[model samples]
Target: MIEIDNISKHYVVDGVAIPAISGISLRVEAGEVFGIIGVSGAGKSTLVRTLNLLERPDSGRIRVDGSDITTLSKDQLLRYRRKTGMIFQHFNLISAKTVGENIRFPLKLAGEYTRAEMDRRVDELLDLVELGGHRDKYPAQLSGGQKQRVGIARALANHPKLLLCDEATSALDPQTTQSILSLLLDINRRFGLTIVLITHEMDVIRRICDRVAVLDRGVLVEEGVVADVLLHPQHEITRALVQESCPSATTGQRLGLSGPLFRLTFLGAVTYQPILQRISAALDVGFNIVEGVVGRIKETPYGQITVQALGDAADPARIAAAFGEHAVRCEALPS
Candidate 1:
């Protein structure tokens, strides 16, 4: 487990102090796929770097597995870094080294494995990343996805319990991104590896992350299970992220078509109800569904339907409250 308590990092540029993170705190559970999401310069990059002590925080404490890493000495910090491996967005494999050699770089640097042992581990890691046949191939010879697999293999070289992925798939195409995400999920399940993935892409988080933290301008706006956060985002930033993941979930005049707007979200038992039928039978409201989509989050029934509510009701608030009681999230839009 990792506990970041009130961590802050600052930089000096031309004699003026600039704050990157301001007293941010978060907890990453063991064997959990946790994500930190934000736009560029939201301090997400700086925060991840702080995990491995790459960007030392000016204040507060960092604890990993009950050890206060923030207070560690130089030698202690080096060992701590080895225990937490990092992967970058660019799949930073050494162009000069073969796939096998790149995977063994960390082990070589630590000087902790024997020749025979290293060879065995390299073979095992290559197979782990599903690149066993590409051991002798150089970075230039492999495709983008293949290069990232090599990067994954190399990151696991030292057998780190925690893996930090800094925008690991932001550069890939959608299909390739999904593939890489699936790989990360597999790695987490197989090794009980605790992964902290930081990205601006919400799809990456929605696909595999168990829980997520949304950061906006260095502040943690929201954090919770991916499904819950996606279905019911508490912060504006989190809502925007979720909306981006499911563009069909949007409200208002859609695709150049002008009409009244309604936002609908279904969860639990209410999701199975024929909402249109219920609305017609219970009230004298007409609906022109502008746009809608039904999607799942972790196999949980979750969806958003947008409809333009028409006609008048004797009790508008009462009807809405009744729908709300059924657990079907609903909101009316203004013209």
Candidate 2:
């Protein structure tokens, strides 16, 4: 596990102090995918960099597995850094080096692996990222997604326990983005590696993150399980981010319905069940679905539906109780 304890950082320029991140504290559990999201100038990049001490915080402590990493000596820091790996948004591969050479770079730096051992590890990583055939190709010869796959292979070359992704998919198209996210998810599940990624894309978090922390202008505004934060956002920044990904999830006012409207949330098996139909019939009330979105957050299936009740007999309390019985949540919305 990783613990960030009230860390803050600032920079001085032209004799003026500008805050980058202030008193941000959070934890990342072992073997889980955690995401940090924010807009530009929100200090997301600065926060993620603090995990590996690339950007040191001016205050507070960073602990990994109960040991404070902030005060490590230079030699100790080097040894500690070997256990962590980071990938960049732009594929930071050497244009002159072959894919296999790039993957072997970290092992060569460690000075512990022999030539044969390094070769074997490189081959294994190539297969892991599905880049076996591209081993002999240079970075300039590969496509954007392929280059990222190579970068991922290189990052995993040293068998790091924690993987850091800094907007790893922002440079790819939507289709390529999905593929890269799938590969990352597969890696996380297969090896139980802890992943910490920073991105501006809500869809990226919705697809792969188990939990998320929202950052705005250098402070942590909200943090929770991916499903909770996405479905019912409490912060304005979070709602706007979710709105960009799925507008229907954020607002139901576009329908302009006359009757009472409600936003219903279904989770897991409840998403597949006909709970709304049964409740409408049993309560002698009719419902009209104004807008709906169904998808999965990581592995859990979820759905949000904006519905309008036909009769004045629809009691909000009773409706909530009925849905609650089936592990669903019913929330009343404005007309």
Q: Which regions of candidate 2 fall more than 4 Å away from where they truly are? A: 249-254
lDDT for each of the candidates? 0.84, 0.92
Q: Give the poorly placed runs of model 1, Cα more than 4 Å off.
A: 248-261, 268-275, 282-286, 310-315
What is the Å distance of residue 182 in model 1 from its true position? 0.7
Q: How accurate locally is residue 59 in candidate 2, as Cα lDDT from 0 to 100?
A: 100
lDDT of 2 by residue, 287-321 (tens): 98888899898889999998888887788888888
Worst 10 residues of 2 by lDDT: 249-258
Query: Model 1 misses residue 84 by how many Å?
Result: 1.0
